[model samples]
Target: MKKVIIAGGTGFIGTYFEKRFNDIGYDVKIISRHPHNIQWDDKKAIVEALEGSELLINLAGKSVNCRYNEKNMKEIMSSRIKTTNILGKCILDCNNPPKVWMNSSTATIYRHAEDRPMTEENGEIGTGFSVDVATNWEKEFFSFNLPKTRKLALRTAIVLGKNGGVIIPYRNLTRFGLGGIQGNGKQKFSWIHIEDLFQIVLFLNNRNDLEGVFNCSSPNPVSNAELMKLLREEMNVKIGLPAPKWMLEIGAAVIRTETELVLKSRWVLPEKLEKEGFIFTYNTLDKTLRNIL
Candidate 1:
């Protein structure tokens, strides 16, 4: 069995990665601040795990949805960068570095497109809260100078699952029949089904040569208004409530980040993943919505 080490393996994405890798005959060891079963400090634990491992995945970070002030921003940036820096040091210490080091990244790296789809080859490098956070995070990750580790930086879009990530807040509002288009409602919403995300992780692990950055999202990107329609329809709720942009700005600012995220207009497409011939089980928004519901 291939041994694998996961830092921040207890987080939102980390938990999912753990279950998938563990079920497939891989010896998985996780490093976390509060270990549920196996625990280790990132630097020391990574060196130990790298001894006979095939892969190492880093998924540590503070939530980006909270306030983006000076303090919270620092925490968000530090959490990702610091953890990876520790992992880099550990990899340096390793007698033999793992075949691959897959780290969590964000689609927020792309600059805002007016309405064009942001492919891996042509994704915009925006400079807002999302872009700033993502840029700084990636900077810290690459600061480590370990050339041997086959690095996989996954630029992930908003994940849509029945239970978590970008779904919770949207589900809450949709439950109350408040699901509607935000701002102009034309903001592009790039998303992937939870299962598709898990499958992508597995696919990346299996493919050794597939290194560098890859965008993880459905080929079909939906607009904010369209996504709202689907969510309401999926829940069998009445088509009610159009959240004005000003209301989102003033009322429930964080709660309305969904509106902002959706309204931001990111037409992101996974050109590289597609070019690499990765098939998605749930590629359509309605199909994904039905599965989750």
Candidate 2:
């Protein structure tokens, strides 16, 4: 059986990938903080896992869903950089490293692009804390030189799925009646279906010629207003109370999270993926919400 190593394979995205790979007959070994898996600090074990593996996907990182306080900020950055460094070093130590290594990156690395869609070929790198985290994460991932292992950075956007992801919170909002437009409702919401994301991984792995950065997002990104409207429609919700900027700020504070997750205009496009003949199963917001809801 083909072997695959998924570092930090405990979260929603990682869990989904683990199950998918297992179903397809790959021997999926996990490297995580969990007792059953190879611990992050175990360099020898990690090297052993990566040796002769077909693929290496590092999804280990502190989630950026919480308040970006000083401590959380530090953790968010360190978790990504440290884990990536470990994986890179381990791969280097291996006699036969994984054929391909796809590390997690964020489309938020691009600026708040309201005017045009940010693609891999032509996207402006943004500023601020989240952007810094994304930039540094990619920098660390690319810092290592492993000639035997092909490296690809997955610049993923907001992932939507029924089981666990942004969908749960959005569903709750719609159920309650707060499913209206958020923060003037003009921000571009770029997202991808979890299944499509998984497919992209396989797609990249199959085509060894593809390397470097690929924006993992849907081609047709919708505005915030359109997103809320479509979501409400799908959920059969008739009444939704819009949350203004001030209200969102208050709510974010109460929830101990940041508003950038909702307010930032992430207009990212999968130019390279599409150009390479990759097709998204869930192409539009309507189709995505319909499948998930």
Model 1 CA deviation exceeding 4 Å by range: 35-42, 254-259
- On the 0 to 100 scale, the lDDT of residue 79 in model 1 is 84
Candidate 1 colliding pairs: 110-124, 110-126, 111-124, 111-125, 111-126, 118-267
Query: How does each model score on TM-score?
Result: 0.92, 0.99
- For model 1, residues 176-283, the per-residue Cα lDDT tens digits are 978987777877888988789888877888887788788999999888889999989989999659888887776556452334465677778889888988999989
What are the candidates' C-alpha RMSDs?
2.0, 0.6
Residue pairs in steric clash, candidate 2?
Answer: none
lDDT by residue for model 2 over 75-163, one digit each (tens)?
A: 99999999999999888889999999999999999999889999998899999999999999999999999899999999999999889
lDDT of each: 0.80, 0.95
Question: How far in Å is the alpha carbon of 136 misplaced in model 1?
Answer: 2.4
